[model samples]
Target: MSKLRNGFIVLLAVFGFAFGSLSSVSTEAQPVRTAEAATTAQQITKINSTLSAKNKAAKKWIAMRESGRSYTAKNGNCYGRYQLLRSYLHYNYTKVNQEKTANKYVAGRYGSWTKAKSFWLSHHWY
Candidate 1:
């Protein structure tokens, strides 16, 4: 009985409890929704106001292809406006986080959004 109790405790530790039961330990995986619509022009203009001419154009072009500038877009393991890998966003899907994370990712991976756009154009993925 003590061995079984210990094993159950380990299981609980491995999978956190919510409402006294495993919240994320479902038997089936939930499907991720595909992108439905592009972000509104007002939102794009607002975000673009923070960038330079070339960068703004590149960013918008990349976003149009990747996730239509929609912060909620998800394709497979990628998520958010830039379609960054899920691990990169850490499941935080707020617009601010998405923007920050995309800039950071682009900076690290391709040095700038313009370069990323160029790469995306060449390979059809970036």
Candidate 2:
């Protein structure tokens, strides 16, 4: 009976320590992407030619509010500066992919970044 009690105590201690260690790891931490790993401004321009200057400003405005222009930003299942769904990115979290997908998304849903910005203004999200 004493041995059984000792084993139970040891097992409890092990699990308690493991849980404590794991709990200290923050799940909300946003990993920073190095400039070399992130998409370049030139690459963005290459793919971002469709948006007018006004629309580009609107897009940047929305990105600032959404994720502080982070390429690796995450919120629940949303990812990237635009906070698009991970599924929309098809599990590809690359910055270029995020930009492309966000562009397509805004175009399909709002027809333009300016329109999306208007929606975000009224709803605080787009």
Candidate 3:
């Protein structure tokens, strides 16, 4: 009975050690994920800041009216913050691509986000 008790104690210690090592590995991984998230957020902030204040405000207004800044927002054939036609994206739907494509489309079709917003205000779409 003493030998059995010792064996059980050894088994519990082995399991405890294995679990401790696994938890430590996961804890070490957490910082890398957090750092990556912070880097991505910083990049997004930089990209957003590139616009002039007026253009940024117009863009935000349109985004709010269209999709409320949701990256995955969809309505019929439109998608993303700008409510762009899915065909316009050629299936590339990353946030960066969405921003770039929206900028180009707004520039091409309306000359600026401000103009697009005006059009939306008058006609309910842009």
Quote each prediction's TM-score. Answer: 0.60, 0.68, 0.75
lDDT of each: 0.78, 0.89, 0.90
N/CA/C clash count, model 1: 0
- Show how many residue pairs clash in every candidate, following the order shown: 0, 0, 0
Q: State the lDDT of candidate 1 residue by residue for 1-126, as single tens digits.
A: 999999999898766646345444442233222121234444545655777889878988888899888888889999988898888888887776677788888889998889999899899999
RMSD of 3: 2.9
Tens-place lDDT digits, model 2, residues 67-118: 9999888899999999999999999987788889999999999999999999
Identify the candidate with maximal TM-score.
3
Candidate with top lDDT is 3
**Best of the two (2, 3) by lDDT:** 3
Cα deviation of 26, candidate 2, in Å:
34
In model 1, the runs with Cα more than 4 Å from the true position are 1-50
Candidate 1 lDDT (Cα, whole model)?
0.78
Return the clash pairs for model 3, or none: none
